[model samples]
Each structure stands twice: as C-alpha cells, then as structure tokens.
Target: MYFRLEDKESYKSQEIGNLIRAYNRSKREEAESEPLNLYVEDEKGNLLAGLIAETFGNWLEIEYLFVKEELRGQGIGSKLLQQAETEAKNRNCRFAFVNTYQFQAPDFYKRHGYKEVFALQDYPYIGQRYYYQKNL
Candidate 1:
C-alpha cells in the first residue's frame, strides 16, 4: 500500500472519520457517541459564545470554544465553560480536556481550573498548541 498527504476538504474529512469510527467502535462501543454543543446568545439572539464537546467513556473533550471579540474579558467565556462543565458532570464525566493554541486563551483555561498536559510547537503554523485537562 502507498500513502500520500492531500486535502480534499469535507469528503476527505468524512472518509477519515468513518474509518476511525469503525476501528474504534470495535474497541470501545460508545466512544464519542453523543456530542454536545453549548452556546450563549445576546438579547438580540446573536451568538456570543459557544462550546462544542463530546464524551468518551468518563471524559469530556472540548473540541471548540469561541467567544465574540466584543464579549471578551467580561467573564462570558468563563461562565460558558462553567456551564459546560456542569453539563459534563451531570453526564458522569470525571475529567475534561481541551486544546488551545499559543495565541489563543491558554491562560483563560488555566484560570478555569485546567492544567496544561502537553504542548506541540509549530503546529499548523508558527505557534504552539497546548493540551489541558481538569478533574471534575
């Protein structure tokens, strides 16, 4: 067999996801079976912050978290994170993990009780990607 790196956008992503799910389902039948999205909206119903996460066994993986620039530094991100954690705990999640880039909110996660577990430098660009976890 031969392998090459190529980007085919959505098609390629879906193909890889299907392959991995098939492989992992054989090992753990319920890994990431139910994904969740949590969001906050302003009075005008515009989205201010959101988090996309999923559970694997007893752990929660936060895939994405974003807050509007106008809402930053106002504790909205912190409140959203706390609400996500509360929901995860309700689902019996014992720990949670998230990854953020160096230019992103590493310090914010740290303040929210997440500890950096690993760091990969020059990933996807010139900055570092930080992996963090917290015990619920």
Candidate 2:
C-alpha cells in the first residue's frame, strides 16, 4: 500500500469510474468462490495504508495500493512493496507487475530493478504511462 493513482480519462473520468464500479461488481460476484486478501496498516488505531492483490497462475496484479499522503517519500512505499514481492515469491510467483502513471514513481521501480514493459503517452495527462515487472 504505497502507490499513487493518477486519475486519467479526463472527460471520461466519470464514465470510466462507472465502468470500473461495474467491473468490480462483476468481480465481487465471484468473491465467495475465490480467494481474497486485504493487507492493511494502521496508526493510532486508524487504518491508513493497504494493498490488494489478485492472483492467477504464477502472477499477481496490484489491484489497489494506497499510502497516506503524510507518509509518502519516507521509504514506507518501498518497504511495503518489498513485502509484497516477498509474498509473491513465497506464493511461487515468477514475477511481479504494476501499472504506473508518468508522474508516478516509474524511476522508483527502476531503482528497485523493475523494468518498463510498456507505456502509453498523454493518458490522463501529458505524461507516459508505465507497466513494470521484475522477475523473481
């Protein structure tokens, strides 16, 4: 739970959001038949950080990641990610992947040995979108 979200889709934000909600509704419909994990962190008894992962075969998608704004840039994100990667490896994951916006920490992932596999430009804003993966 240490990544940021760049709400793209501009004029389509609301529409895209609706679509996401609908998509999530469908995914939730199968929740009872599938495994779900919610990892979270709290401070002063208040939940502040978390991550959600969906797994299939040997892969996991970081469906959601969040860290309180006041807690950013202090290595918390990196540590959380390290934990996620460790967990992925423990589960026999061959690699880990995440999507990031151009304004996000693409360089941060690079520093942690993740390589960019794809990118789309001018999405949500005037920046490069990124998909990164690191082999376990």
Candidate 3:
C-alpha cells in the first residue's frame, strides 16, 4: 500500500520514534543487556556498512544489515550474509532467522540458501512480510 508523500513521512517518523523510545526504556530496565555485534570492512578506511545479529532462544536473528546503496549489486550483501551465517553456526544456533517487508531482503536470503518459513500479507504495512531461516 502506498500513501501520499506526507502520510508516508508521518508513518516513517512515528515508527522510528517508537523504536527510540522502546530502546531507551529497555536500556533502563536492563543495565547490561547484550548489545548487537557488527562486522564490516571499510571502503576507504573511513566509511563502512555491515551486519548485526541478535540471539533469542536457539536462533540468531539477522537483526539489521546494510551495504551502502552505492555498493549494492557488487556482492557486498552476499559477503555480509555469509559472515552472519558463519557467526550463527559458531554460536551453536540451530537456525538463523530474519524478517523483511515486501521488496526487502527475502530474495537475498533465498539466494544465500535460506528458505521462506513464513509469509504474511499486509504485514507491518500493506506489504508482504517474509521470514526466512537456515538450519545450521
């Protein structure tokens, strides 16, 4: 579902705001929560983008991942994904999971040997939501 530009901006900001508030609350609740670990390589020793994973039960979730837009289509996403999967295995997680909205990383995960474990229509917004997993 697409909305007018103004509405889109409003929705985006609202979502981000909620995340910030929740993060702050969690920080106060648990002073020593495990922070996500990220891995990346610098392009010019100054700038870089990477991936992070979070643990929950027997699964490691690919919490966030990015390879600068300019660096897309250059195998960066693949390398980052490979590294994340390796990290998952090292942690003894039986599976790795990630969710993405429509037009997001579902295709990327599929190419990297993950299988679609769940798909929901109109999720988060009016787009499909995909959850993928790879058994380790």
Candidate 4:
C-alpha cells in the first residue's frame, strides 16, 4: 500500500467521503441526509446572506453561514439562522451543531442560544475553533 495526499477538490477525496458516508448508511438505517439551505436576496435577486446546512437522523449540521460584509450587523445573519433552525425543527431535528473560528461568529451563535461545547486552541495557527450546539 502507498500513501499520498490528494488535493481537497480531487475526485479521490470526494470518493473517500462517499465511501465513508456509504459505510455510515450501512450501519444506520436513518443515516440519510437532507440539505437545508436558506438565502436572503434583494428585490433584484442579489444575495445578501445565505446558510448551508444538512439534516440527518435527529440532528442538523450547519456547514456555513455567510453575510455580505456591508450587510453585517443588520440582523440578516440572525434571520437566516432563525429560519434554518425553524426548518430543521420542522424536519424533526432535535439538535443542531456548528463550528466556527475565533475570528468568525462565535458570539453570534451564542446570542442565538447555541452553547459552546468544545474549543480547540491554536488551531490552524494562532487561533481557536469553537463547536456549538443548540436544542431545537
């Protein structure tokens, strides 16, 4: 056997993810995943903010939440997060989890009632990574 690093976007990397997912599905019948995405756009269809997430079993995993820099502090991110949480609840999800960096929106998640469950310091450099969870 040989070992080599593949680019993040390489086909082998994606295939590896698929293999893991397949194995998980084989172990759990309820391992199917559903995307739960939300977006805020202007009248002209310009995107102002967006959220990307997924629901599996009884949990919602938030992948990303982004807001236009100019639109920050305007409550757009809060709205998107609220909407996503509502949708996750509707999908029968009981919990949601997300991770953010120290430079990202840790306080924002906390303000939305997410509790920081873990923190990894000196992660990816001289910063911290925080994992948060909320009960829906």
RMSD of each: 2.2, 9.5, 7.5, 1.7
Q: Write down the worst ten-residue block by lDDT for model 4.
A: 5-14
lDDT of 1 by residue, 1-136 (tens): 9887876577878998999988978886565546868889879998878999887778888999999887798888887788888988988999999999988999999998999999999898788999999999
The order of the candidates by TM-score, greatest first, is 4, 1, 2, 3
Candidate 4 structure quality by residue, lDDT tens digits, 1-136: 9989765688887898999988978887766689999988999999888999999888999999999999899899999999999999999999999999999999999999999999999998889999999999
Residue-level lDDT tens digits of model 2 in 19-129: 997898787643211222545466666766666775555666666666788988777777777787777777777777788886667887899888889999988677788
Candidate 3 contains a number of clashing pairs equal to 0
What TM-score does model 2 achieve against the real structure? 0.66
Once fitted onto the true fold, the runs of candidate 2 whose alpha carbons sit more than 4 angstroms away are 1-40
lDDT of each: 0.87, 0.72, 0.74, 0.93
Most TM-score-accurate candidate: 4
**TM-scores of all predicted structures:** 0.86, 0.66, 0.66, 0.90
Model 2 weakest lDDT span, ten residues long: 29-38
Q: Which number leads on lDDT?
A: 4
Runs of candidate 3 with Cα error greater than 4 angstroms are 1-36, 41-45
